[model samples]
Target: MNFLTKSYLAYSHGEKTVSPWVILKPLGWLGSVIVGTRRAFYDHGVYASEEPPLPVISVGNLTTGGTNKTPFVEFIAEQLSRWGLKPGIVSRGYGGTTSEPVVVLNGRGDRSVVGDEPLLLSSRLTDVPVAVSSDRMADVAALLDHDVDIAVADDAFQHRRMVRDVDIVLVDATCPFGNGTSLPNGILRELPGSLSRAHAVVISKSDQTSPEALRRLKERISHWVPQERIFYSRLADPLWERWDGERFVPVGKNMTAFSLTVFSAIGNPHSFRNTVLKSGAAILHEFEFKDHHHYDANDLQKIEDAARKSGGKAICCTEKDIFNLPRGYVPRVPLYVPRISALVEEPGRFWNVVVQALRPQIVVASNGYGEDAIGARLARKAAQRFPQAEVCAFPLVGSGIPYKKIGVRILPPLSKSPTGGIIKYHLRDLYQEIKAGLFRQISRQLSAWNQLRSSCRTVLCVGDAYLLCHTLWGQGKKALMVATAKTKFISGHWKLESFLYRKGCRKVWTRDEETAVELRQNGVAAVFEGNPIMDLSCD
Candidate 1:
């Protein structure tokens, strides 16, 4: 371990007292305050969180390092797929070199490009699509092309910008909470109280700790979350396979004479060692590297030298380490990779919670007062049509008063523009709105829609072409447009607007029959829905 990790572990475990305790304790307190305050922003609505259109399952941990997130994510994806749901995985690509979102199709992307965890997931779950990007919203948007019905986000506990339907947090059984302190002084990324945000808490590596200790940990965790939501899991099913210049093939334990030199670049190298030992193989020598370490020619050479000197018939490492190895560098010694899977207790109940979160959603969006009126009716119509699905509203112009009046839930509110979304009539107000951060509002609105609009079962856009543009920004599938702002008796829609309607919308509902007929002549799929906006005044 490095000096920082070593010191952190020592302090957290209460193993040693350091001279810098005076300095470290205060800093840890400060960190806790900052993290808590930031969370409060999201909790109290000071910051806006975007709700995903599709059901999103987030696997994250409160601790700084691995709590076996990748294995659990794999388990979730496999389960979702078995249940007939087209699931996709997204990661922040922590330790990757790429900036743009890279889709891992058929497990083809390089580990160096997409990061080790995502590449490993893609390789194992070949049928499941994986996307890696710093902006996870971009990753979700990219997955839409694959027709994914749901998404599983890896290591996204604190990524509250995009709200998850199901939040599954993993806690290490051996070190559930570090020394009861925050980071820099301990291992906790946040306070134990954050467990309240988690829909389910998983005690990972449950086999690593004694039953008595595990029970006590559960009691402490229950203070923050419900006891029924807590689940136990362990990494099980250890197998050894050898690389044959193409892929790993199952190898017998006797193939290496039961002696191996094990090396790994993972968060918990000791866990890997324990797994190897469980296979009844004696470890002759061991090489350990930092988590996600990139191995070069020199590193490989040293590992090979150690294997030969120890007289070990084979060199072994975890499956994740294979990706970090130098490309096409064949080792002189026989190389083996250990594959392990997570075994969760009461899997049926755990999966039931996940399945429940996969419920579909409908989003009603509008930009103006009259548009909001139409959107309110659409929201009611959607709620009546799909009673089992969630119905919500996204107001692009102001606080969704119309939706609020109708008792429909509204997304995070944005600041209203100076002209109240009527910039065309009062062009001078556009400059004033720009000064009031109109561009920023538009960007935020688009980002809000990108995930929620993209994953929603249906999108109802009520407004002019400008609102339609925002509606379609994140929606991969076509949307239903209720054009309330324009009419044929006045000035009709422009050619560009008609083209957008024909190409982007599945069907456009006009305020009057004349406008619908005019749009039909131009090959647009238009319908006269009888002015819902006029009915608003009658009510």
Candidate 2:
């Protein structure tokens, strides 16, 4: 299911109040094992290709969509061609019917078979070769047979099956990693550190960002992939072209002017809409589709109806969407196409890293605690250590020992608290809102956790009172969940501590003077620790 649907279900059902870690723990391990096995195969050359024909540049992002990868790929292709090199574009042809490499000669051809992106590219750049295939490796091989010099692989950053000479990772200027968690949990495809494999980083849609924001983004990226070069790129609107089936017409403000508005099924629809709005045209109506949504007769009919109702002069759309238009659909409406090109600055540094990687073989080497998780003293220590990291100390974990167990919350913005002060507790009346608040908190925490994992090498998680630490441990992060004697002193919620122990947290730092002795008697590794606040003050 999509993220929104899953979120709605979790919120409506009050599932967030119950610990998801309990259910996700086993499945997470299974996923880890599967991932590990897959990595081993790729590392062992089990999936390696023999005598790969030409250099492949894979452009992709960790999240599902939002990053403008297509335009980035187009930018690279255009650059290569300008440098007097032949470039062939290959895509997975998402939502397309064909599995074989289908060459799209023009936009008039079967969009369903070749997909919108390839068809669009084919129409815009007739000289460039564009092909679509589910199996990229086969497509690349086929391109090689046709004497293609280099292959530009779209959205192939996670496709480790084929070796790429240069990996360009793109991040959306805004919402780089939504809710920062992996799929079903958040939006990440793999873990965050995955960007370390990228030869260069491109912050797409740089126009929307300020200089300071861009710098901060660069710093964050540098923290994870310190060695990789970074560049800023923005989308530029070329001359608006309208296709009337027989010929292409280029028009400016002088021509018979009409307000142009657009909606698209592309990953980042907002960008498409904003581009149209930026153009000196009136936006009468807009309709968005799910990413890679295949258009049907009904969809087209609805769009036509909307256009007719708007009574606006022209219907503008993204080239990607235009490629998906049903046969004879464009003729029905005065279709205006605004061409998008990537305006890249500081290409020298970005391309230099790519060239350097090509010269030699690139070798890539690649949270939680709970209360005992929270106490005034523990909070003081955390504040000292992680002044920037948001601290969330709550009673939701149900750990019997309040002082010893504390939960650290990350990514605070996603959660929303009620506006008014606490009302006399009414469980039934506040049920839905409480449940929604909890889900939002968990969602934000998950996003923050994923973002932290992606950006940091080591994260310290205190308090084993909650199962959140268990969730972190499951994801293969180095996490230390501490539980003190004060934490065990509490009763009903303290039962949750057992869940943390079950999830493989080796060290439980106890606040009790005799914690080591007591844990040894119970066959748990418990070390006695002096007050954490003292350490914080000294540092």
Candidate 3:
């Protein structure tokens, strides 16, 4: 290892001895403040989160890098796919020239436009599509358009803006918590305290650690996440693709004793090196590039020189690095890649978490014209977005004539309001209507759903959100209340009668940014999704 690399690694693992790397400590403190402040902004509803159209699972880490994110990401995606879900990946595309989010894989496109990590995923996942861009929301939205059932974000532990159904955090078992500091000073991206928000914690590369090490890690992780939410995983036995004489062959065993030069451009090269050694390869030479480094002709030439210098028989690389290599540019010596599989320790339990998140089908309760329209639109689109799911809809007003026209399954309405909840315009009618036991009828219907709650998943309240009575009052499997029409059209915001109703909502998506912004200004976690009415048109 280089001097700086060694020093940084030592510092990251809690070494306090003063060194040149210590100069950056103050900067780390500054970064902590900024990161904390931004998170506080999200927590306080200053900046609201937008939920992806499909159910999303986020895979990330507390440390800045070297958590073996891709392998675990692959693990989660594959497991989800095995359960008959069409899962897609959304990545930041760390190293690439592209600005807009684009589909990297579907048997079309190359590395230059798609970025390396996305291309890596494309090659690994035969059943799923991979989209890459810095704009996560755009990429996710596009993925939903491709009929993706579930969305997985590669590294989004701190991405509060994109609300996820489940946050699957990967803690490197080798170094579960890094020096317990934030950035520059250490490897931590967020303080350990923040892990409390994670839905599950995964201990990656557990194969390299001792049982005692894993026990200690679990003890610490249990403080943040429940023991049931913790999972263990490791990279499985590797299939080495090597050039055997004239033709390239995949090396399964026995060839590991042969001397080879290893190279990689991933977050955790040390972990990669250790895995290579464990595979029984006699290390001849090693080249470590910065994470996500784009390889070139000169780099390949240098690797060849290293192989010749060490008298190595072959050059080995990671499966992730294969995409960046020039197409059809076969080298003189064998260019082999270790095709590793991400194997979860307990597959049944890990898959159960994903299946549970996918179970919550929407129950739209539209109380008015605009709301009924939006609800029907979303109901149809929901079916399209989650075709594997059995979606249920409940129009809370006007006989659900529009829903009937569109072949949507409508739940029993709560109560019929003659004034249609426009009490200001028809107060006398509203009074007479309420006096005739409208509240009682509504109570009876909410009770019916509450009883059969096992049959359905969420309570989707559309229209004037405040008008939603007992439907969102207490019956909470999962609930979403959306504002279909802009509040600007109806003057100021509604008084929010059941102010406590906001607490019951799993999520609240608004039709426009202005309305959502105002809602957040008043401390409501309302997400702005561009006109769901238009979004459903594609469905």
Best by TM-score: 1
What order do you get sorting by lDDT, best first? 1, 3, 2
For model 2 the local lDDT of residue 252 reads: 54
Please, what is the TM-score per model? 0.71, 0.60, 0.69
Off by over 4 Å in 2: 1-37, 44-51, 106-109, 245-247, 253-258, 360-539
RMSD of candidate 2 to the true fold?
A: 18.9
In candidate 1, list every pair of residues with a backbone clash.
53-452, 53-455, 53-456, 54-455
lDDT of each: 0.81, 0.60, 0.72
Provide backbone clash counts, one per model: 4, 31, 0
Q: Which 10-residue window of candidate 1 scores lowest in summed lDDT?
A: 42-51
Q: What is the C-alpha RMSD of each candidate to the true structure, in Å?
A: 9.4, 18.9, 9.5
Q: Write the per-residue lDDT of candidate 3 for residues 1-539, one digit (tens) a residue.
A: 36777678778667655667778788889988988988765543345344567777888999977787887788778877777888999988777767788886643566777777787777678667888877887889989777898899989878777767777888998877667777878888888877776767889899899999899989988987789878998888787777433333666755556788988877677788887888888878988876767788888898988998898878888777766666655777777777777777777897676567546556667777666777787777778887766666666555777687878877664456676655555678778768867777666666665543323444567766543544543333335777654464556466563243354455667767787777777666678876666665455
lDDT, candidate 1, equals 0.81
- Candidate 3 residue pairs in clash (backbone atoms < 3 Å): none
- Model 2 has an lDDT value of 0.60
The worst-scoring run of ten residues by lDDT in candidate 2 lies at 360-369
Residue 319 Cα positional deviation in candidate 3, in Å, after optimal superposition: 1.5
